[model samples]
Each structure stands twice: as C-alpha cells, then as structure tokens.
Target chain A: MEEVLRIEDLHKSFADLAVLKGIDLAVNRGETIVILGASGSGKSTLLRCVNFMEIPSSGRIVMNGRAVGRAVDGKQTYSEKELTRLRARVGMVFQHFNLFPHMTARENVMEGPRTVLKLDPAECARRADTYLDKVGLAWKADAHPSELSGGQQQRIAIARALAMEPEVMLFDEATSALDPELVGEVLGTMKELADEGMTMLIVTHELGFAYTVADRVLFLSEGRILEQGTPAEVLTYPTQEGTKNFLRGHGSFRLPEPQLD
Target chain B: MEHVWDFSALLNNKQLLLIGLRNTLILAAVCLGLGLFFGMLVGAARYSKKPLLYWPSTVFVEVFRNTPVLVQIMWFFFAFPIISPFDIDAFSAATLGLTLNTTAFSSEIYRAGIRSIERGQWEAGKALGMSYGEQLRRVILPQAVQRMLPAFMNRAVELLKMTSLASVIAYPELMYQAKIISTIEFNPIEMYTSVALMFFAIVFPLALLVQRFELKHKAR
Candidate 1:
C-alpha cells in the first residue's frame, strides 16, 4: 500500500508545557490507525498537527509525497490559499459535532462543496442528499442541527466531512460525547466506512471498537508512543507496563457477553 | 367654563406636518441602510488580527460613541463643507451625521455578535477547508446576525429618535416643523402633542415587532 501521510520528528509546545515530543508516524492507504491514550497524552494534539489545526513546533509532514503543513523553511510554509487546498484532502470530525445550527442537515453537508468546490447549486444539493443517505440521514434532509439528537447531529457531521471527498479522515474522539446507547450507531457508521476501505486516523477510548476495527493500534503516553502493533499484540498482550496498567484500569479487556434473550 | 382643547390649527397645517414626517422617514431609511453596510465592514475589521485594521476600527468606534450626537451633527453641518472639497445641504449634513453615528453603534453590535460565537465553529469551518471569508459569510455571520437582530433593532429605533436632532440645523424634520408652527400659531401644547403622536405612531409598532422576535428566539 502507498503511504498517504508521513509525520517526522513532530514536536509541539505551549509555553513551557510540551505536548508532543519528537513523534513520528506514517499512515498507509486504506488503513485504519487507532490511537489509545490517557487524557493529556497528546493523542488529540497529534491528530490536530497532522492537519495543521495546531501547527507543530518542528516537523516535516508529507501527504501523498507532497511536503505540506507548517514547514520550517520560509519558502515551504504554505500560504492561506495553499493551506486551504491541503486541508480539503484531509477531513476532520470534531468531538462536539459542530454542525451549523442555522442550516438544515442537507445544507450543512453541502457547505464545503458549495463554497470550496464551487459546485453549482443543483450539484451541491444532489451530493448533499447522496452523502446524507450514506450516513443514514436522508430522512433528516430538512432538519436543523438544533432539531436533531446528539448522535444524529454527529452522523450528519460525518456526512458533511465525507461530502468534501477527502482522501483521509481524522476523528477526534468522535463518540466520546455520545450517550452509551447512541455510541453503537456512530461506531457502526464508522465500521461501515472502514469496510469501504477508507483511510482513517482515530483517537478514541473504545477498546472493543479499536480491537475490532483498527488495522494497527498505537499506545501513547506522555507525548510519546509507548508501544504500537496489531490489536491482538497491543491490546490482548501489551508488552509495556503502562499500556497494561491503562487497559486494566479501563476494563478487563474481555469482550462483553452477548445477550441471547 | 370648561377650557376646550382645539386641534383645528394643527390640522390646518397637515401638509407641512406630512412633509416633515416624510423627510424624517426618508432620512432614517437612507441612514440606516448605509450605516448597516458600512458597519459590517467596520465590524469585520475590528474582528481582524492585523493592528492596521483593528486599531483604526477601534478608534472610529470610540470617537463616535464617546462624543455627543448633537456635536457631530453640528460639526458635519458647519465644519465639513469648509474643510472638505464637497458642499452639503442641511439635509445631507443631518443624514451623514446620523449615518456615521449609527455605523459606530451598529459596528459594536456586530462585533459583539461575532465575538459571541464559539471558537469551535471557526475550527470546524477550517477543518472542512473553508477560506476565512467563506467561514465568516456562511458559518459565522449567519449565526451572528440572528443573535444581532434585537440589538440591531434597538439601535435602529434610537437612530430614528436621533433624527430629531437634525432640527437644530433647520432641516425641517417633525420637531423643526412643530417648532415653526408653535411660534406662528401660539399653540405649543396642541402642535407639539401632535408631533409626539406622529413619532409614537411610527416607533410603537417597530418596538412591538422586536419584542415578538425576541420571544420567538427565546422559545427556539
């Protein structure tokens, strides 16, 4: 598989607090990478840096072999226009859903295509409906975010990001805010996308979903990847004491019993 | 003997009063329209990070807001034509003064509305690959403008009331017309009362509309 994203020697700092320290990562096409970490472990920051939402203090980020995102060289640092172009290929789903409250679900989906793609009105609407249906939101085409439940709103957000036709999707704890019952619906949508062979980088706490869906899982601790490997190796039998302790604290690492009744 | 209140004299001067009312409304409309347009630009500039744009916008808002509206009217009426290349009549002077004043107030309202929007909204727009202008026009402003309607309406009503200050320059607004009639007919109570009623007729309905909108938004 071809490399879709590469991060080298990435470091991020806010004042004296160093969030990311000399991290490196490479993502291949059609691969799902799940990052598991405790709070303040820089998992979210690393995802943010991948898309230049938070500029890395020092790094080289190459997307599809093109050097992009906060380059150290004055000539290489992308302009606002260039940054917008780069960002289009990398869609990000925020934790809060962040749907435009004033617009209907369909309009929210169409916003990027209409504005960035400069698509005609009919094309925009058609694509919006198509993507909304993909996320199981075709019935909610006319409903506003304020009128939708949290899960529905998040699903609509996913549809909106997909409308941009990004080659890679970054999910920042996408299901953390969802109610437990609603979490399944969102995770199911993600699983469907994964089955379709979408390249995704996800920061999440759902150990079961990570073990089931992620091609590879990375365990991060204190701004560094403490360990990374296949889910069975890392989750089922973690080599690092930190990873083992973290997983034990979260759960027994045993799958829940299925209800037959 | 009961003293009878007579309105015949004021009614006889109906044509003059109507002209005054028409002028006031036209002036208010022109000023409000131009003020809102200019105010959006000023508000955007205030929101910008560049000191070149932000400092100048801040100075403009402070200068106009801190001073008295009547003084601004007088300065534009008297000093503007003398110092500037263009000449202006009393009506233009009044209109310009009110527009500038309204722009300053409206800009602040716009600033507040824009600022009130969460930073997460902008982050979401950026993450979707939107340009700054696109994010502002599609995402930020739509949400901000809805929040601004009540405050904007309040400022508009205040602008309408401020038009009476134009009477100082003999612009023949309702108050000016009433002053002339009161001097000529010696009927201050009836003539001024009629002018007050005319203002009430125009403003009361607008206030009610704003109240209705506020209630509806609250329900949402």
Candidate 2:
C-alpha cells in the first residue's frame, strides 16, 4: 500500500500544558483509520496537526512524500501560503457543520473551487451539483445552511470538502454534534466514502462505526496511542488496561460478534 | 405683539445657500468615501495579531476617537499648519479632521462586525485552503457586511451632520451660509429653520432606510 501521510514524533502543546505527546502515525492510501479516545485525549489535536490547523510543537508531517513546513534553524516554520496550499489538498470536516450561513449549500460547496481553484463558474457549479448529489442533498443545494437540518447541513459540509477533491479527508467528530437519529445519515455517507476507498483519518466516538469501517483502530489515552490493532483485536480484546477501562466505560454499547466460518 | 416675518432678503441670497449646500454635500461625500476606504485597512490592521500593524492602528483609532471632533478640526486648522509639511486651508483642514474621525469610528464598526462572526466560519474557510485575505473577502465579509450595513448607514448619517462642523472654519457650508444670512437679514428664526429643514430632508430618509434594514436583518 502507498503511504499518503506520515507523522513522526508529533508533539503539540498549549502554553505549559501538553496536549499531544510524542505521537507517531502513518496512514496508507485508501485506508480508513479510526481513532477512539476519551475527551482531552488529543484526538482532535492530532487530526488538526495533519492539516497544520494546529501547528505541532515539534514534528515532521510528510504528506505525499513532501514535508509540510520548512525547517529554519532546526525549527519547523510554516508560511501562510504553504499552509494554504497544504490545506487545499487536505480537506477537513468539523464537528460543527461550519457551513457558511450566508451562502446556499451549492455556493458553500462551490466556494473553494471558485475562489481557490479559480475554476470557471460553470465547472464550479457542475462540481457542486455532483458532490451535493453524492451526499444525497442535490435537491437541497439551493437552501442555505440555516434552512437545513443538522444532518443535512453536515452532508452539505461534506460535499463542500469533497468539492476540493482533496487527497485525504479528516473528520473531527463529524457526527458528534448531530442528534442521535441524524447520526445515521452522516455515518452512512462516511461509510459509502470508505467503501469507495477514500483515505480518511477520523476522530470519533462511534465504536460501532469503527468496528465495521476502520482498516485499523487506535485507542488513545493521555496524549499517546495506548493500543492499536484490528477491530476484533482492539475492540473485542483490548490488551492494555487503559484500553480495557476505556472500552468498559462504553460497555453499554455492544460490538458486533466476529464472523466465524 | 408678534414681529412680522419677512423672507425677501433671504430669498435674494438663496444662491449663497445653494453653494453652501453643494459644499456640504461635496465634503460629506468626500469624507465618507475616503473614510470607508481607509477604515477597512485600519480595521484590518487593528484586527491583525502582528504588533507592527496593531500598535500604530490602535494609537490612530484611540487618538481620533477619544478627542472631540470639534477640537480635532480646530487643531488641524490652527495647530497642524505650524508642523504640517503641506499648506492647511480651511477645506483641507476640515476634510482631514472629519475623514480621520469617520475612519476611526467606522473602523470600530468594521472590527466589531468581523469579530461577531464565529471562529468556525474562519476555520471552515481555512479548511478549504483559503488564504486569510481570501477567506475574509469571500466568506467572512460577505456575512459581516450584512450585519454591518445599518451601522455603516448610521455612520453616514452622523457624517452628514458632522460636515456642518466645517462651517466653524468658515468653509461656507450650509450652516455657515445660514449664519451669514441670519445675521444680515435679521431673520435668524426663518433662516435657521430653513437650514434645519434642508438637513432633515436629506437625513430622515436615510434614517428610515437604516430602520428598514435593521428590521429586515432581524427577520432573517
């Protein structure tokens, strides 16, 4: 498998408090890696670092074989232009839908292509329609985000990210903000994307979704990867006590039984 | 016993009032245009995190906003000329004072408007690979400007009134001409009333439009 992203000795700190402590990760193309962690375990921070949204205190983030930030005097330095270019290829969907409320769903999806890509209007519109259709909200394209339900808005946000045709997609608790019933639609859209072999790094609490969709599942505890393995290994039988306690905390939910031939 | 009201002298000098009105309009228009244009730059500078941009803008905003506009006009007319590289005529002095004053106030409006937008909107723009300028222009301002329209209109109305201050420097604005007419014609009541009516005619409609916009914004 081709490696699409690599993080080496990643560290992130906010003032004196350390959020992400010496984390390392490599994601392969067409891989869906699910990160499961308790609140404040730095799952979101890790995802944010990949896109350079939160600059890692010290780390090497190599995407598609190129280091993201330039090294100046042995310290990583990021220029706004470089970060902008980096973000163009790495799309992110936030927990809050974050759709531009002033713009219609179609225009929200069209914005990146129209403004950044500088594509012709017709092409941007066409791409918007295609992606909105992909997310099953083609009919709602003309509607503003304020008019759409949480699930529908999330779907439109997904379309907006997809319109950029990014090399990788990061979902930072995308469905966590939705109502219980609405979670299904967003998770369903994500499942379809996974099925179609999209490279994804998702920080989510949805253990059931992780069980079914993840190529690999990582359990993070206290700013470090505590355990990682196949869903059957990590979810069914977590070796580390921290992972076990974490799973036990979510004990009310049941994981699917492994298929036996 | 009531003194009889006479209008013949005032009517004869109506041409002077017309020029005054024209000067008032020109000064207001020029100040508003330059103020809004520069206000965006100063506002963005104040909003920026860099100290290089932030400090100068902070000082500029504070000095212009805290001091009285009347004093500012007087300073430019009387004091600025001593230190000023260029000549400071009455019109130039008034323009300098009023334009800077408008810039200071309107920049606060712009800053507040931009700040009111949620952080998520900026993140969303960045996530889609937009530079700071692009994000502001395309996503943030498009929304902020909607919330800011009424405030800007109010500024314009205030600016229209503020132009009358130019008359203090004897620039022959509406108020200055009215002062002359009232003194010469001995019809202070009628002349002042007419000048007030002219100002009301121009400003009232704008006030109504601002109200309409506020109501519409609330509806949305």
Candidate 3:
C-alpha cells in the first residue's frame, strides 16, 4: 500500500535533553495505529512533531508524496508556508479538546472549512451539521463549548477536525481528560470514525481499545519503540522481556484479549 | 426661600431652553463618539508591550485624569490658540476637552475589562487557526467591548454634565445660553435653577438606563 505519511531519522531535543532520537516510521492510509507508552516516553512529542506543532531538530517528514520537513545533514528544516500547509493536512486533537470558546459547537466545526478550505457558508454549515450529527452533537449545535461536558467537548473537537476532511487525524490521549463514564462516548465516536475508514494515529493507555480496535500497536519506553506488532501478537503474546515486564506490572492479572482454548 | 423657588421664567423662555437642549444632546453624542475611538487606542496602548507605547499612553491618561476639566477647557480654548499657532472656536475647544477628559476614564474601563478575560480564550483562538489580530478583534475585543459598555456610558454621562463647564469657554451650548438669558434678565437664581433642571433631565434618565443595562448584564 502507498504510504500516506512517512518520517525518517527524526530527532527532537529541548536544550540539552533529547526527547525523540532518530526515529523512522510510515503510516498507510486507512490504518488505525495505536502508540502505547508510559508517561514521558515521547509518544506525545512524536505526534506533536508530525503536526509541526513542535519543530523537529533533525528529520525528514513526507506527507502525501510531498517532502515536508527535510534534513540538512540530519538537522530538520521547513519553509514557513510548507509547514503551515503540512499542518493543515494532518489535524491533531489535543488531550483537553481545546475548542474555541466564543463560537458555538457547529461554528467551531465550520471555521476550518470556511477559513482554511474556503468553502461557502451554506455548504460549510451543512458539512458541520453532518459531522456534529456523526459525533451525536447535532442537538448541541448552538451550545457553547463550556456548556458541554468533557466527553461531549472532546467529541465536538473530533467533529471539528473531521470537518476539515484532513488525510489523517492524530489523537493525543483524547479520552484521558474524561471521567470513566464519559470516556465511552468519546471512544464510541472514534470507533465510528475508524469503522468508516478514517486513518488515525492514537496515543492511548486503553489496552482493550488497542487490542480490539487498533490494527497494529507500537509500544514505547523512554523515547524508543520497545515493541510493535499486531495487537493479537503484542498484547496477547509479547516476545520482549521489557514489554512483558512493563505489561506485567501495569496490566495486573487481567489480560485484555481472550486466552487460547 | 421664595427667590430660588420661582419656576415662571423657565416656562416663559421654553423656546430658548429647547434649543439649548437640542444643542446639548447633539454635542454629547458627537463628543462621546470621538472620545471612545481615542479611548480604545489609549487602552490598547496602555497594555502594549513596548515601553514607548505604554509610557505616552500612561502620561496622556494621567494628565487628563489628574487635572480638573475646567483647566482642560481653558488650556484648549485660550492657551492653545497662542501655543497652537491656530485659533479654534469655543465649541470645538469644548469638544476637544470633553473628549480628552472622557478618554482617560474610558481607557481604564477597557483595560480592566480586557484583563479579566481567561487566558485559555487566547490559546483556544490560536489553535482554531486565528492570527493574533483576529483573536483580538473577533474574540477578545468583543467580550471586552460588552463589559466596558456600562462604565463607558456612565463616564459619557459625566462628560455630558461636565459640558456645562464648557460655558466658561463661551461655547453657545445649553449652560451658555442659560447664562446669556440670566445676564439679560438679571435673574441669577431662576436661570441657574433652570440650568440645573436641564442637566438633571438628561443625566438622571441616562443614569437609570445604564443602571438597568448593568443589572441585565449581571443577571446574564
């Protein structure tokens, strides 16, 4: 399959400390990939760099057959306009679902299409209404973001990103801010999007969601990918001692996948 | 006791008083519009990051706010004619003084309103692909503008009351007309009382409207 996104030799260092070290990865279209990690493993940094929200110190990022951030002797650089357009292609959903306060839920979704995509108002409103309905927030079209709960807000954020019709979506712990009951609504919305063949890269601790919903899962430890395979292989039958030890400590006796008969 | 109480002269000179009322109303509206434009600039400048913008705006506000409105009138009307190298009339001078006086207070009201908005609002605006100017115009300023309105209007009413002071500059506005009539008829008590009634008629209703608007905003 053609690569929808590719990164080579990625490195991000803040001051003296390195957060991402010479990483290479490619994502195929219509794939649901989960990046699993302990806190501070640089998964969030990696996702942020993909969206160009953080500048990579050294890397080459190619999206949709275009070279985005290229390496100059293993140092990263991009033209200002190139980076702006690249970010518009890949939408990032924050952990807190940072929706605009002055706008209603529908207006929030319509903004990108009207401003960036330059769609007409009537068409944009129709698109926003469809996306909001998909996220089960049609009833909340006129409501301000503050009026919604965390999960509803996160769903609206998802719809807002989806309204842009970007090639891929990045979720940086989308459900982490929600209450336990609220988490289900957001996950269900994401599941629907995944089922509809929207390419997604999610950083999550939800092993059950990763095992059942994700096509493949990459496990990271201390800024490195520790293990990667189909969830059936990694979650059910992890080969590396580091992966096993990490899961054993955090997973307890509950195996997310069913055991062999 | 009876000297101040007679309301007969005011009834006889209703035409003069009505014309004065029209001029006062128009003058207040024009000065307020001009003042708020300068006031928004002053408020933005006061919060500007650069020292030059901040210092000049600060000095302007302090000079106008600390000095009496009467001094501002005399300076613009009498002193500025010689210092300015051009002779502007009494009405124009009064307008300039009133605008500068009201600008000082309006700027402070706006500054306080802008400061109260949540920091997260800016972050959200930026994330939604809005540039800094758009964020200020479409998001921050609208909220600030609504919050600043009651205080802005109250200060405007004060500027209107202070317009009576414009009589000292020889502007033919409401109080000036009343003074001209009093001097002609030799009825200081009756004329001054009529002037007070004219001032009260405009300011009291406006004060009540502003109070109601403020209460509605608070309830919301």
Q: Tell me, by lDDT, which candidate is best.
A: 2
Best by TM-score: 2
Report the C-alpha lDDT of model 3 over A155-179, residue by residue, as the tens digit: 9999888888888899999999889
TM-score of each: 0.95, 0.96, 0.79
lDDT of each: 0.91, 0.94, 0.83
What is the C-alpha lDDT profile of model 2 across B169-199, one tens digit per residue?
Answer: 9989999999998898889988988999999
lDDT tens digits by residue: candidate 3, B1-220 = 4455666776787788778778787778888988888888999999999999999999999999999999998899988888887789988898988888888888898899998777656544444445567668766887777888899879878988888888897777789889888877778788887789878987999999899989998997
Best by DockQ: 2
| Model 2 root mean square deviation, Cα atoms | 2.6
lDDT by residue (tens digit), candidate 1, A1-261: 799999888889988999999889999999999999999999999999888888777777889998884545542365788778878889899899999988899989999998888989998888898889999989999999989988999999999999998999999999999999899989999999998999999999999899999999999999999999999999999999999999889986565798889
Poorly placed runs, candidate 1 (over 4 Å): A69-76, A252-259, B1-3, B79-82
Predicted complex 1: CAPRI docking category: medium
Error of 3 at A49 (Å): 4.5
lDDT of 1 by residue, B1-220 (tens): 8656889989888888889999899889999999999999998899889999999999999999999999999999999999989998999999889999899999989999999999989998998889888899889999999999998998878888999999999999999999998898888989888889889989989899889989988998
Decide which is better by DockQ, 1 or 3: 1
Give the higher-DockQ candidate: 2 or 3. Answer: 2
Per candidate, chain B TM-score? Answer: 0.95, 0.97, 0.92
Q: What ranking of all candidate models by DockQ puts the best one first?
A: 2, 1, 3
